[model samples]
Target: MEQHYQLLRKHIEEICVLTDEEWDVVAQRFTYKSLKKHQFLIQKDQLVPCEYWIIKGLTKAYAIDSNGKEHILQFAMEQYWTSDFNAFQNKVPATIIIDCIEDSEFFCLKWEDREYLCHEIPKLNHFFRIKSHYGYIALQQRILSLLTETAEERYNNLIKKMPKLIQRVPKKLLAAYLGVTRETLSRF
Candidate 1:
Protein backbone atom coordinates (compact mmCIF):
# COMPACT_ATOMS: atom_id res chain seq x y z
CA MET A 1 0.00 0.00 0.00
CA GLU A 2 2.82 2.38 0.77
CA GLN A 3 4.42 1.65 -2.58
CA HIS A 4 1.15 2.36 -4.35
CA TYR A 5 0.85 5.55 -2.37
CA GLN A 6 4.33 6.52 -3.53
CA LEU A 7 3.29 5.80 -7.10
CA LEU A 8 0.34 8.12 -6.68
CA ARG A 9 2.62 10.69 -5.17
CA LYS A 10 4.96 10.39 -8.13
CA HIS A 11 2.11 10.83 -10.56
CA ILE A 12 0.95 13.89 -8.67
CA GLU A 13 4.46 15.26 -8.72
CA GLU A 14 4.41 15.07 -12.51
CA ILE A 15 1.33 17.31 -12.51
CA CYS A 16 2.85 19.67 -9.95
CA VAL A 17 5.42 19.50 -7.21
CA LEU A 18 3.83 18.50 -3.92
CA THR A 19 5.40 18.79 -0.51
CA ASP A 20 5.96 15.51 1.32
CA GLU A 21 3.23 16.34 3.81
CA GLU A 22 0.83 17.37 1.08
CA TRP A 23 1.49 14.12 -0.78
CA ASP A 24 0.71 12.19 2.38
CA VAL A 25 -2.60 13.94 2.75
CA VAL A 26 -3.49 13.28 -0.87
CA ALA A 27 -2.49 9.62 -0.70
CA GLN A 28 -4.38 8.90 2.49
CA ARG A 29 -7.78 9.31 0.84
CA PHE A 30 -7.27 6.69 -1.86
CA THR A 31 -8.10 2.98 -1.59
CA TYR A 32 -7.00 0.29 -3.97
CA LYS A 33 -9.13 -2.30 -5.72
CA SER A 34 -8.55 -5.08 -8.23
CA LEU A 35 -11.05 -5.75 -10.97
CA LYS A 36 -11.35 -8.67 -13.35
CA LYS A 37 -11.79 -8.40 -17.08
CA HIS A 38 -15.33 -7.64 -18.27
CA GLN A 39 -16.19 -6.29 -14.81
CA PHE A 40 -18.16 -3.11 -14.59
CA LEU A 41 -16.37 -0.42 -12.64
CA ILE A 42 -19.40 1.76 -13.21
CA GLN A 43 -22.72 1.00 -14.89
CA LYS A 44 -24.59 3.31 -17.21
CA ASP A 45 -27.24 5.55 -15.64
CA GLN A 46 -26.08 4.55 -12.16
CA LEU A 47 -24.90 6.98 -9.54
CA VAL A 48 -21.08 6.83 -9.47
CA PRO A 49 -19.55 8.62 -6.54
CA CYS A 50 -15.95 7.67 -7.17
CA GLU A 51 -13.23 8.34 -9.76
CA TYR A 52 -10.32 6.03 -10.45
CA TRP A 53 -6.65 6.10 -11.32
CA ILE A 54 -5.48 3.08 -13.25
CA ILE A 55 -2.40 1.63 -11.66
CA LYS A 56 -2.34 -1.15 -14.23
CA GLY A 57 -4.52 -2.56 -17.00
CA LEU A 58 -7.08 -1.04 -19.31
CA THR A 59 -10.57 0.37 -18.90
CA LYS A 60 -13.01 1.81 -21.38
CA ALA A 61 -15.86 4.26 -21.03
CA TYR A 62 -18.68 3.43 -23.42
CA ALA A 63 -22.40 3.63 -24.02
CA ILE A 64 -24.90 1.44 -25.76
CA ASP A 65 -27.10 3.06 -28.36
CA SER A 66 -30.80 2.42 -29.00
CA ASN A 67 -29.82 -0.10 -31.65
CA GLY A 68 -27.57 -1.80 -29.05
CA LYS A 69 -24.40 -0.71 -30.75
CA GLU A 70 -21.51 0.04 -28.44
CA HIS A 71 -19.89 3.44 -28.80
CA ILE A 72 -16.61 3.82 -26.95
CA LEU A 73 -15.95 7.31 -25.68
CA GLN A 74 -12.52 6.84 -24.19
CA PHE A 75 -9.94 4.35 -22.95
CA ALA A 76 -7.79 4.64 -19.86
CA MET A 77 -4.64 2.61 -19.46
CA GLU A 78 -1.81 2.67 -16.94
CA GLN A 79 -1.12 5.93 -15.14
CA TYR A 80 -4.39 7.40 -16.39
CA TRP A 81 -7.40 8.75 -14.52
CA THR A 82 -10.97 8.03 -15.52
CA SER A 83 -14.54 8.67 -14.39
CA ASP A 84 -17.97 9.62 -15.61
CA PHE A 85 -17.45 13.39 -15.75
CA ASN A 86 -21.17 14.13 -15.62
CA ALA A 87 -21.62 12.05 -12.48
CA PHE A 88 -18.37 13.21 -10.83
CA GLN A 89 -18.80 16.92 -11.53
CA ASN A 90 -22.56 17.46 -11.49
CA LYS A 91 -23.60 14.82 -8.90
CA VAL A 92 -25.86 13.30 -11.49
CA PRO A 93 -26.36 9.71 -12.62
CA ALA A 94 -23.89 8.45 -15.24
CA THR A 95 -24.67 7.92 -18.89
CA ILE A 96 -21.33 6.20 -19.52
CA ILE A 97 -20.18 2.85 -18.19
CA ILE A 98 -16.57 2.13 -17.23
CA ASP A 99 -15.58 -1.48 -17.83
CA CYS A 100 -12.33 -3.28 -17.32
CA ILE A 101 -10.97 -4.78 -20.50
CA GLU A 102 -8.23 -6.56 -18.61
CA ASP A 103 -7.63 -7.60 -15.01
CA SER A 104 -6.78 -4.32 -13.36
CA GLU A 105 -5.61 -2.53 -10.26
CA PHE A 106 -6.82 0.98 -9.53
CA PHE A 107 -6.80 3.57 -6.79
CA CYS A 108 -10.10 5.29 -6.25
CA LEU A 109 -11.21 8.43 -4.41
CA LYS A 110 -14.81 9.08 -3.53
CA TRP A 111 -16.51 12.36 -4.41
CA GLU A 112 -16.38 13.61 -0.84
CA ASP A 113 -12.72 12.75 -0.54
CA ARG A 114 -12.02 14.46 -3.84
CA GLU A 115 -13.78 17.59 -2.63
CA TYR A 116 -11.78 17.52 0.58
CA LEU A 117 -8.54 17.22 -1.38
CA CYS A 118 -9.48 20.10 -3.66
CA HIS A 119 -10.42 22.29 -0.73
CA GLU A 120 -7.31 21.41 1.20
CA ILE A 121 -4.89 21.44 -1.71
CA PRO A 122 -5.44 24.10 -4.30
CA LYS A 123 -2.64 22.74 -6.50
CA LEU A 124 -4.40 19.41 -6.73
CA ASN A 125 -7.49 21.17 -7.98
CA HIS A 126 -5.44 23.01 -10.55
CA PHE A 127 -3.86 19.75 -11.68
CA PHE A 128 -7.24 18.09 -12.18
CA ARG A 129 -8.66 21.17 -13.87
CA ILE A 130 -5.79 21.09 -16.33
CA LYS A 131 -6.60 17.48 -17.09
CA SER A 132 -10.25 18.37 -17.57
CA HIS A 133 -9.37 21.23 -19.87
CA TYR A 134 -7.16 19.01 -22.01
CA GLY A 135 -9.86 16.37 -22.25
CA TYR A 136 -12.44 18.93 -23.33
CA ILE A 137 -10.09 20.33 -25.91
CA ALA A 138 -9.43 16.88 -27.36
CA LEU A 139 -13.15 16.17 -27.50
CA GLN A 140 -13.76 19.39 -29.37
CA GLN A 141 -11.01 18.53 -31.85
CA ARG A 142 -12.46 15.05 -32.41
CA ILE A 143 -15.91 16.53 -33.07
CA LEU A 144 -14.59 19.03 -35.58
CA SER A 145 -12.49 16.42 -37.32
CA LEU A 146 -15.44 14.07 -37.59
CA LEU A 147 -17.66 16.79 -39.01
CA THR A 148 -15.21 18.05 -41.60
CA GLU A 149 -12.54 15.43 -42.27
CA THR A 150 -12.75 12.48 -44.62
CA ALA A 151 -12.80 8.96 -43.15
CA GLU A 152 -9.39 8.12 -44.57
CA GLU A 153 -7.95 11.32 -43.15
CA ARG A 154 -9.43 10.55 -39.75
CA TYR A 155 -7.96 7.05 -39.85
CA ASN A 156 -4.52 8.38 -40.74
CA ASN A 157 -4.69 11.01 -38.02
CA LEU A 158 -5.73 8.42 -35.46
CA ILE A 159 -2.88 6.14 -36.48
CA LYS A 160 -0.44 9.00 -36.10
CA LYS A 161 -1.88 10.41 -32.92
CA MET A 162 -2.75 7.24 -30.98
CA PRO A 163 -0.58 4.54 -32.38
CA LYS A 164 -0.63 2.55 -29.16
CA LEU A 165 -4.41 2.52 -29.24
CA ILE A 166 -4.41 1.14 -32.77
CA GLN A 167 -2.16 -1.68 -31.58
CA ARG A 168 -3.95 -2.44 -28.27
CA VAL A 169 -7.61 -1.67 -28.79
CA PRO A 170 -9.78 -3.91 -30.93
CA LYS A 171 -10.04 -2.71 -34.50
CA LYS A 172 -13.85 -2.77 -34.44
CA LEU A 173 -14.00 -0.43 -31.45
CA LEU A 174 -11.33 1.84 -32.97
CA ALA A 175 -13.39 1.97 -36.15
CA ALA A 176 -16.47 2.91 -34.20
CA TYR A 177 -14.61 5.69 -32.45
CA LEU A 178 -13.40 6.95 -35.81
CA GLY A 179 -16.97 6.83 -37.18
CA VAL A 180 -15.95 4.36 -39.84
CA THR A 181 -17.19 0.84 -40.41
CA ARG A 182 -14.89 -1.97 -39.41
CA GLU A 183 -14.67 -2.96 -43.03
CA THR A 184 -13.62 0.55 -43.90
CA LEU A 185 -10.97 0.58 -41.21
CA SER A 186 -9.56 -2.72 -42.47
CA ARG A 187 -8.96 -1.17 -45.84
CA PHE A 188 -7.12 1.79 -44.36
Candidate 2:
Protein backbone atom coordinates (compact mmCIF):
# COMPACT_ATOMS: atom_id res chain seq x y z
CA MET A 1 0.00 0.00 0.00
CA GLU A 2 2.97 2.31 -0.44
CA GLN A 3 1.30 3.61 -3.57
CA HIS A 4 -1.77 4.45 -1.54
CA TYR A 5 0.43 6.35 0.92
CA GLN A 6 2.01 8.31 -1.91
CA LEU A 7 -1.37 9.25 -3.32
CA LEU A 8 -2.64 10.28 0.12
CA ARG A 9 0.52 12.23 0.76
CA LYS A 10 0.05 14.07 -2.50
CA HIS A 11 -3.55 14.91 -1.61
CA ILE A 12 -2.69 15.99 1.92
CA GLU A 13 0.21 18.05 0.63
CA GLU A 14 -2.10 19.85 -1.77
CA ILE A 15 -4.65 20.53 0.95
CA CYS A 16 -2.21 21.53 3.65
CA VAL A 17 1.51 21.41 4.27
CA LEU A 18 1.86 17.93 5.72
CA THR A 19 5.11 16.97 7.39
CA ASP A 20 6.59 13.56 6.68
CA GLU A 21 5.66 12.42 10.19
CA GLU A 22 2.10 13.56 9.74
CA TRP A 23 1.92 11.77 6.40
CA ASP A 24 3.19 8.60 8.02
CA VAL A 25 0.32 8.65 10.45
CA VAL A 26 -2.14 9.10 7.63
CA ALA A 27 -0.46 6.37 5.60
CA GLN A 28 -0.70 3.79 8.35
CA ARG A 29 -4.49 3.91 8.26
CA PHE A 30 -4.95 3.18 4.57
CA THR A 31 -6.00 -0.16 3.16
CA TYR A 32 -5.73 -0.80 -0.55
CA LYS A 33 -8.09 -2.71 -2.82
CA SER A 34 -8.64 -3.36 -6.51
CA LEU A 35 -12.19 -3.36 -7.84
CA LYS A 36 -13.50 -4.63 -11.14
CA LYS A 37 -15.67 -2.51 -13.37
CA HIS A 38 -19.34 -2.37 -12.30
CA GLN A 39 -18.42 -3.77 -8.87
CA PHE A 40 -19.56 -1.86 -5.85
CA LEU A 41 -17.43 -0.01 -3.35
CA ILE A 42 -20.49 0.71 -1.26
CA GLN A 43 -23.75 -1.03 -2.07
CA LYS A 44 -27.15 0.57 -1.58
CA ASP A 45 -28.82 0.02 1.82
CA GLN A 46 -25.62 -1.31 3.34
CA LEU A 47 -23.68 0.31 6.16
CA VAL A 48 -20.71 2.38 4.98
CA PRO A 49 -17.62 1.00 6.64
CA CYS A 50 -14.94 3.00 4.90
CA GLU A 51 -14.25 5.97 2.67
CA TYR A 52 -12.05 5.54 -0.36
CA TRP A 53 -9.42 7.59 -2.10
CA ILE A 54 -9.15 6.70 -5.76
CA ILE A 55 -5.64 5.97 -6.93
CA LYS A 56 -6.52 4.66 -10.39
CA GLY A 57 -9.55 4.38 -12.70
CA LEU A 58 -12.97 5.84 -11.97
CA THR A 59 -15.94 5.47 -9.59
CA LYS A 60 -19.31 7.10 -9.03
CA ALA A 61 -21.75 7.45 -6.13
CA TYR A 62 -25.39 7.15 -7.11
CA ALA A 63 -28.89 6.48 -5.82
CA ILE A 64 -31.72 4.49 -7.31
CA ASP A 65 -34.89 6.47 -7.80
CA SER A 66 -38.34 5.17 -6.99
CA ASN A 67 -38.80 4.26 -10.64
CA GLY A 68 -35.53 2.27 -10.57
CA LYS A 69 -33.44 4.88 -12.35
CA GLU A 70 -29.89 5.50 -11.18
CA HIS A 71 -29.15 9.12 -10.43
CA ILE A 72 -25.48 9.87 -10.26
CA LEU A 73 -24.48 12.06 -7.36
CA GLN A 74 -20.75 12.39 -7.91
CA PHE A 75 -17.84 10.84 -9.73
CA ALA A 76 -14.30 10.28 -8.47
CA MET A 77 -11.09 10.06 -10.46
CA GLU A 78 -7.51 9.65 -9.35
CA GLN A 79 -6.84 11.57 -6.11
CA TYR A 80 -10.55 11.96 -5.35
CA TRP A 81 -12.40 10.55 -2.32
CA THR A 82 -15.78 8.81 -2.53
CA SER A 83 -18.13 7.73 0.26
CA ASP A 84 -21.55 8.11 1.81
CA PHE A 85 -20.59 10.37 4.69
CA ASN A 86 -24.06 10.33 6.18
CA ALA A 87 -24.03 6.59 6.62
CA PHE A 88 -20.45 6.62 7.78
CA GLN A 89 -21.25 9.26 10.37
CA ASN A 90 -24.46 7.81 11.73
CA LYS A 91 -23.81 4.11 11.27
CA VAL A 92 -26.94 3.90 9.18
CA PRO A 93 -27.54 1.97 6.00
CA ALA A 94 -26.44 3.87 2.91
CA THR A 95 -29.00 5.23 0.51
CA ILE A 96 -26.37 5.47 -2.24
CA ILE A 97 -24.23 3.06 -4.17
CA ILE A 98 -20.56 3.68 -4.86
CA ASP A 99 -19.45 1.70 -7.90
CA CYS A 100 -16.38 1.46 -10.06
CA ILE A 101 -16.76 2.49 -13.66
CA GLU A 102 -13.44 0.84 -14.49
CA ASP A 103 -10.98 -1.56 -12.92
CA SER A 104 -10.04 0.66 -9.99
CA GLU A 105 -7.50 0.94 -7.20
CA PHE A 106 -8.35 2.76 -4.00
CA PHE A 107 -6.99 3.57 -0.55
CA CYS A 108 -9.62 3.15 2.12
CA LEU A 109 -9.86 4.41 5.68
CA LYS A 110 -12.43 3.47 8.28
CA TRP A 111 -14.49 5.96 10.32
CA GLU A 112 -12.65 5.13 13.55
CA ASP A 113 -9.32 5.91 11.96
CA ARG A 114 -10.57 9.33 10.92
CA GLU A 115 -11.65 10.05 14.47
CA TYR A 116 -8.21 9.01 15.66
CA LEU A 117 -6.69 11.53 13.31
CA CYS A 118 -8.65 14.32 14.96
CA HIS A 119 -7.51 13.22 18.39
CA GLU A 120 -3.90 12.61 17.45
CA ILE A 121 -3.26 15.61 15.26
CA PRO A 122 -5.34 18.70 15.84
CA LYS A 123 -4.21 20.21 12.55
CA LEU A 124 -5.90 17.36 10.74
CA ASN A 125 -9.18 18.44 12.29
CA HIS A 126 -8.88 21.79 10.53
CA PHE A 127 -8.05 20.06 7.28
CA PHE A 128 -10.98 17.67 7.55
CA ARG A 129 -13.37 20.41 8.59
CA ILE A 130 -12.52 22.30 5.45
CA LYS A 131 -12.96 19.18 3.39
CA SER A 132 -16.39 18.57 4.92
CA HIS A 133 -17.38 22.17 4.27
CA TYR A 134 -16.54 21.83 0.61
CA GLY A 135 -18.46 18.59 0.45
CA TYR A 136 -21.51 20.37 1.79
CA ILE A 137 -21.13 23.21 -0.69
CA ALA A 138 -20.73 20.83 -3.59
CA LEU A 139 -23.83 18.91 -2.57
CA GLN A 140 -25.80 22.13 -2.36
CA GLN A 141 -24.59 23.21 -5.77
CA ARG A 142 -25.61 19.87 -7.28
CA ILE A 143 -29.10 20.13 -5.81
CA LEU A 144 -29.46 23.65 -7.16
CA SER A 145 -28.26 22.56 -10.59
CA LEU A 146 -30.79 19.73 -10.69
CA LEU A 147 -33.51 22.25 -9.89
CA THR A 148 -32.42 25.06 -12.20
CA GLU A 149 -30.42 23.67 -15.09
CA THR A 150 -31.71 22.04 -18.23
CA ALA A 151 -30.55 18.53 -19.12
CA GLU A 152 -28.29 19.94 -21.84
CA GLU A 153 -26.88 22.48 -19.44
CA ARG A 154 -26.10 19.77 -16.89
CA TYR A 155 -24.57 17.57 -19.57
CA ASN A 156 -22.45 20.49 -20.80
CA ASN A 157 -21.31 21.20 -17.26
CA LEU A 158 -20.38 17.56 -16.73
CA ILE A 159 -18.26 17.64 -19.88
CA LYS A 160 -16.55 20.79 -18.66
CA LYS A 161 -15.83 19.26 -15.27
CA MET A 162 -14.97 15.72 -16.36
CA PRO A 163 -14.51 15.71 -20.10
CA LYS A 164 -13.12 12.19 -20.12
CA LEU A 165 -16.22 10.70 -18.49
CA ILE A 166 -18.34 11.43 -21.57
CA GLN A 167 -16.47 8.63 -23.32
CA ARG A 168 -15.91 6.52 -20.21
CA VAL A 169 -19.32 6.34 -18.55
CA PRO A 170 -22.06 4.49 -20.41
CA LYS A 171 -24.21 6.91 -22.43
CA LYS A 172 -27.42 5.78 -20.74
CA LEU A 173 -25.85 6.28 -17.30
CA LEU A 174 -24.60 9.68 -18.35
CA ALA A 175 -28.03 10.66 -19.61
CA ALA A 176 -29.68 9.54 -16.39
CA TYR A 177 -27.16 11.55 -14.37
CA LEU A 178 -27.99 14.64 -16.36
CA GLY A 179 -31.76 13.96 -16.27
CA VAL A 180 -31.85 13.41 -20.01
CA THR A 181 -32.89 10.52 -22.23
CA ARG A 182 -30.16 8.52 -23.97
CA GLU A 183 -31.35 9.79 -27.38
CA THR A 184 -31.17 13.41 -26.18
CA LEU A 185 -27.68 12.92 -24.82
CA SER A 186 -26.66 11.29 -28.10
CA ARG A 187 -28.11 14.21 -30.05
CA PHE A 188 -26.12 16.62 -27.94
Best by TM-score: 2
Worst 10 residues of 1 by lDDT: 162-171
Clash count per candidate = 0, 0
lDDT of 1 by residue, 8-40 (tens): 888878789998888879888999999999999
Alpha-carbon RMSD of each model: 1.5, 1.5
**Residue 56 shift from truth in candidate 1, angstroms:** 1.1
In candidate 2, position 29 carries an lDDT of: 79
User: By how many angstroms RMSD does model 1 differ from the true structure?
Assistant: 1.5
lDDT string, candidate 2, 121-175, tens digits: 7888887888788878988888998999988888788889779888888887888
Off by over 4 Å in 2: none
Give each model a TM-score. 0.92, 0.93
